[model samples]
Target chain A: MQTESKSPLELEQCLKCSICTAVCPVMNNTDAYPGPKQCGPDAERYRMKDIRFFDESALKKCLNCKRCEVACPHGVKVAELIQTARRDMSQHGPGLREIMLANTDIMGSLATLVAPIANFATGLQLSKEVLHATVGIDHRRTFPKYAGTKFETWYHRHAAQNQGQFKHQVAYFHGCYVNFNYPKLGQDLVHVMNAFGYGVQLLEKEKCCGVALMANNMYNQAKKQGQVNIDSMRKALQGGVETIVTTSSSCTLNMREDYPTMLGIDQKDVKEHLGLAVRFISRLLDEGNVKLVWKEGFKKHVCYHTACHMARLGWNVYTLNILRQIPGLELDILEQNCCGISGTYGFKKENYELSQKIGSTLFNDIEATNAEAVVTECETCKWQIEMSTSLPVINPISLLAEALDLEATQKANIR
Target chain B: MKYNTVIIGGGLTGLVSGIQLQEQGQRVCIISFGQTLLHFSSGSFSGEESNTDVQALLKNAGIATVAGGYRLTPLGELRPAALTLEGYYHSETAELKEKSFAIVRLPKYLGLPIEFLQDTLTAQGREVSIITPDEVVGCPAEVILVPACKAGYDLKKTYGKRVSLIAALPPSIPGQHIHAKLQQYFQKIGGTYINGDKVVRSTLQTDEKGVRVQSVETQNLGDELIVADHYILASGSFQSEGLQSNYDHVWEPVFGVDTNAPEDRTAWTALDFFEDQPYQHIGVLTDEAGHALVEGRPVSNLYPAGHILGALRTDIQNLNDALRIAKNL
Candidate 1:
């Protein structure tokens, strides 16, 4: 925990303005969580004597919402404050749930053993509720079930299909969620890459990007995790992978922006990765790199929900611009503030209702659009949208690669 | 109302005038709508004389030591007055200390936070410190930062960008539009201001002790009594109160505010014309005791201040002159 050194004069300037709260979708839904201003500087004012406190459930409730930062008049850094508070609580003996959540590297490696058992465990009606209760998670949400086969297993088996695509190749970073829960998205990404005439190599020997750990305020752990990820990316770059492509928006944002400040990685290399590696499935197709076989008679209306992490990294417009190129697809740009799932946020039982409330705006927007499908770059957003709406929510590349008539993509979708 | 004195206009001059009177153990009631100072203030003080020869003219008009800038030595007595001043020139070291700790104005549209900005600057090896005054009424930064003055709105969030909040008094979009609304609201909240009430004549009520300003006739308000133990004349510059020469004699409305002004506005105008002309000498005559001169006798309470009555140009520099006038009062 950081030493309490900020003065009362420093704390008094907050003015109790709820502008920060107004923008936080997490606070909009959850009653237990005071918005950023309240939990942050507002709460900082009323505490007796010092800033140190024991329990920090209120501080950890921030869904990593960047909206409050945008709405603040005084430019109060609410996100950093919340993260610091969480770090303080974690140091004061963070419970087993937090430790388990923060150590994704351990979880990622254990996926092979836990995959089937996890599915069976999650199948029990009371399992998720019990897990939420133990972890301080709100009781009304569901997590994505683990995939039958992990993404790495699939990537290694089909390594020889791209005999001689483009000389230029990209290093693929399949994040934990895409690797465990939605492995097919990674497989679809390969097909999309091949059609675009690029040599795509999966950096299967990668660790958790640790962005989630950082969000949960496990800074030192996040730094260590970031170093491992950075080393893997650095090696891939040395092996002639010009750009690092990843399906996860959170992973892309971390590698592109956060890693440089947090880990002192080669800033130029990171920027190059940002300029090129940071791309969505629909974006690759729009860039004319991926060959899309548009379904002969399929004409559909779809809305794209820009993810908050992706939006903060400034990749939102690029995704939207790419979507504009599809011939028969009518796109509704859903100005979603946040999906409110934010990885683990929606799955927590305590936050589930708040997540639903925060997500209601997006849910209503998707419903109002009356689109046949909802397309987004993030798998968590896809899951959150799927939970609320009856419309099919799929990865943007899955749609684009299907349009390209990739035989494997067609085969996978039919199943 | 146990008011020993009622000071009108809540701008810098008025506030300082009241502060000085309060320090002197007098009960001072300041009537202000609070939109007197222009929001954009640099807060520098230079004490140089304007070319207008107003001090010399006032001297010729039989008034010897009109209050001006002083370089206070260790002895504490004000030294010989400097003619022209700029920004907020302070004669004492105490005032200089405040200026060094002044916060730079942070403009809007810079999408960086104050801490981040500070970190970035510190990384670049620049020494930047911020200071806040005691009373803050609105949008305080993550740090409880206050403006240099009451009307100082532009906050320093970045190296160079101005930021201010739009109060919802009149409800408009929150930029310059809201600022305009607040300014109008300030005018309304301040004491009675009959719009377009132009003062044209001055009358003196002389007694054994001193000459008192009896009343003045405005074009609209007619004869309004400005009765008080003290009077502050801060009607602003020529653009605000019109100090133009009709034939040859240079004069101002009500009490001949700046009696020693240039016969022709061209004489006081700048060579660049566009550049700020140094015309601090264009002001009313005053006796050596820092009292206003009515025909040759000192008016006990009538005080000339700000851009209107000046030994220095307030625009280019004379902030210290304004401060001194307020402090001495």
Candidate 2:
């Protein structure tokens, strides 16, 4: 692990402004982290106090929501700092959290081996509490139940098709969680992408981005993961492909924002390549390059939960704008704070309530909109929203995919 | 009760003209209605157009005074303080005369911060500066502050993120949100602010005889006249009554000074679409010594400034022009 020599001055210009905290849904909901200002420079200042062992648990509560970055006066890169800090604290300090966060590949292998037991354990409150206490996850937030079948296996079995529907080839990055748990969503992404003129090529060999490790406070492992993803992306660039779309907002943010700075990966050529590869799924759908077959008389009001990472990255507007412009769609924008699913943190028993409380504002807004369904670009947010509200929480790309069925419509017209 | 000089419209042009008239030890009063472009302005001044032909168009209009005339070579730029229009009007030299201004195009979502843009331009160019928000934005150099057309609510959300509010008028106008926000931020940071007052009539309140303006009675309550030897009218366009425009003539409000404006409204529409419009060239005429002129006659103590003037067809073209006009005033 290469240590960053200077630690980039620890964001001294942050001014301890509470504007970010005031807007932060996580801070509003959870006492696990004392808001962004305190977690950042306010907490960073006490580092010189000669305190025994930094309580890096504060770092884990950041849902990596970019609300602070948007509200910051000096435009401090808050999300990047938090992610970096998570990595730093995890690696520098020794713990079970480090092992869990750092060793995602091992976790994936073990997850596949004991898939049924893992699912069973996820259902039990005792297992969840044990995992949270052991891994430093606040046990209040709810996580998605892992699908028994991973995305790739299902894709090869059900969807490997020249279905005469998908036309262009797109490089799909099945983020670890999507690859292992929600593979169908990945398949749906490919199907929708194909419907929008892209033929799906699963970059099956891609590995973990170390985001979990970074969250677990393992910086070095996360950087390695970032480097691996960057190399994978670079290979796609050499293949002359331009668009790299992913269903994971955090994965994209990690690759787009964290990779270059943390790993020192993505040199000038790779940087440009990564920039092209760095788009979320909704951005691809909104590019106006693809023609979507409009579903006639399909009426639904869509309220968007602006995912934190996506909001900070400014892609939420692109998603909202595209959804609003869809032929048979009506979109109501909801810009609430974090959904309180700081990824795996919500799955832990401790963070569960905090996650729910932080997400309460969003839930209220969603209910007020009374939207037919809640739409989000991030898979994590989709899972969180679905678990919280019984309403269908869909990724925008999946909806667009369903909308692009030309033959079914022709048959309907013929009938 | 009449003053030696009456300038209307509380915009930069009237402010400068009044300052100049007052410095000459003449009696001056500037009356204005509400708001000025200065508050919402990104204060960079430029006369360059994208097309060389447009530059030629400016020259043909008799406003181009650069060395290349209308054909601005890379070196060609306007030096406003050095320019003596019609060979007579000389107020004081402008502060910007020592600094040349750079023209910058701001992005749609991001604004060109007025202070930042001014500093950046002044740092890059020669002496003598005036910069205005370009025609693309359609904002005029008037004293009225309204929501920008594209993102009216966008700026209101950030009313005083950086700057402080000094004063506001009508206090209850719909624009008070901007005033309130600016006031909140500015006052929180110890910036002084005044509200609910208007300058109605101005005269020399001092023995040295500077422009002194008295607040006049209006339908609105709690109005008092202000008396000052000099005045700055940041009051905006005809819509805000900074300058009164009618079928027969154009005039600055408090001064009753006739503007050397075009007789017809058709001259106001430079081009059809908003983007290509070059209406800023049409504004009030001034003599060589920078006196407001109407058909070759100078209106004594009445400065036709800001959008009230006829020579500038569009008020939002450039801030330097107003600054230059202000310097001359």
Candidate 3:
């Protein structure tokens, strides 16, 4: 008998059953790239002897959506295996376009500084053509408009002082999307939390969760940012704030799961306290610690889309439970399909066509539902769905804030 | 989160139970880890033998099985199976009475045991000719047989001929279609199905109703409990990780349900390789009404359905037991 015990995700457990290949959205859309089975365990066995055993070119087409991992009955980390190989076999570093897309916090901060000019220039047709030619950002894509006032700026000025009166306090990690593109989601999260008698505080320092960085093969930069985020969580936990929540599904997945596995960041101390806002709040409601009272005569119809990352996190059930609790909300759940805009994957010129093709099934289904709006948890999904379809895609937290009876909830939850 | 019922597995039995419970207006949730073993089948379900609505239930999902009472195996042997994908080869008798047959060799495919099938058919005194897809138009044969994988399901309509398909090995396209349709139908009817998660722990309280499950915890839903009025353990047998084994013991991993495992390792198997083995049939213990047992006491609210209850191997038996249990709950 061997002395060592096997990890649950050992590569030897792969059954070579091709179920991973079936669930891969990338493989189904493109023949240029082999499926997860070929790129992952099938190649890893050969690559164990030498790194050059398999060609690394086809690995680039992977969307890193982690659906293969979700579909594997034996729990093999197919996406992680492919990603680790990319990290190891990569000979060339990220180019200017990748760096621009990967460093989300830096670009977000710069754009928000000159929000009006940045939004106008980014949306201009001539600028799109020039950037598509020079920078390789797809011309057909429109950038997420930067907020005029950042969430941090607004939070410090407006909501920081009044937080001290609440009975319980929790830290918020409003990620780059909330900090730069949409401050309203941050405002909504605060409204939902404050109504539950919980004080929401920002971390002393924060950085982009670096999901985009990792996908772009910028592991070192991702690790650097991941360390910064972990340190802020450590300080927050030291101050007795046990739970730190976020609005973005990708950020939560990056910190909770991908940090130690992909970037080699030790998030052991912080993972337990870190979660999505839906999970934390839904747990509170389940345990009878809080209740949500919606506004009178409120009625809305929305189709909830399961973002790829949200499905990987397995916390979509919590978000769905929260949506189902609304008295007048007519919720229709769309089948879980990858919207094909996996963060920066769909924004590149070469990937532009393939991404839309991969998402066509979802687009058709959403049209069939014809709900008034689309609801989802990931900001990137919101960006993809809203760009592809004519309907507005809003986050679940925003929906809660829209219908929540702030006065009644605040009075009821005064612990 | 709370529901009227929570199912441990999302395979055939668990899904049937969930559908039955939801049809009764009981809010239901099913926690499934990875894909089910339904992917290993060729859309072969066996509930037509029982007085159950399983045939109609599956028909509503657009997965109509052939009406014949037999199925053609990939190895050219005919077996009795109540259900097969609509276009598959199924007949009433074991023998293919057709005088001449053409088996189209699916190029670049190895899932079917073609050589073994040819050898078996030739020994049975049947005229079998292997032909390429290019020769299908000119080939003179009573009927044409084709492998299902790596080929379209609408072979009959596409070729405008007497085409019969057989399921190659898994990943079975026909079976996956069945699962996807049923799962979609389940969700469309308001049943909540949480994918890629498993229940890891359960809290049991002994009240007037002899030990009841108060709540359960899942691997992914950390620190939160899934509270339900009733729970079903349909996590499949050993191959599916419902029951796990170590050096000397076999036990049910979820909820610590009592299992019918031999204590000593020596008693796990028979002398011959093909002989019956104790390990293959090992599973959790449940009372007649399908209430799961712990330490010989039945948990009043916890029911064990499907193959996890042991002594169940056929699709009809699983559906009948799952439906009967769901109705009692």
Ranked by lDDT, the better of candidates 2 and 3 is 3
lDDT of 3 at B9: 92
lDDT of 1 by residue, A242-324 (tens): 77888777777677666765455655554555332325443454445444455566567888776776655445434554555
Q: What's the residue-level lDDT of B61 in candidate 2?
A: 30
TM-score of 2: 0.52
- What's the C-alpha lDDT at position B296 in model 2? 57
lDDT of candidate 2 over B1-329, digit per residue (tens): 12344444444454444444444455554443333443332111123322243233223333332211121111222233322111111123232232333332324323224444345434545332233233313332221122222232333344322211111111112222322233233222222122212444433222344222343322111122333322334445554445555455556655444454566767655665765533344344566654555445653333344554433333223233443444554
Candidate 2 per-residue lDDT over residues A54-100, each given as its tens digit:
46667767776667765453445666666655555454564675576
What tier of docking accuracy does candidate 2 attain?
incorrect
Interface root-mean-square deviation of model 1 in angstroms is: 23.3
Measured by DockQ, the strongest candidate is 3
| Predicted candidate 3 versus true structure: per-residue lDDT over A137-188, tens digit per residue | 8999878999999999999999999899997999999999999999999999
Q: After superposition, how far is residue B293 of candidate 3 from its true place, in Å?
A: 3.2
By TM-score, how accurate is candidate 3? Answer: 0.91
Off by over 4 Å in 2: A1-12, A15-17, A29-34, A42-63, A82-94, A101-109, A112-117, A129-143, A157-168, A271-288, A406-415, B1-329
Models sorted by TM-score, best on top: 3, 2, 1
TM-score of each: 0.51, 0.52, 0.91
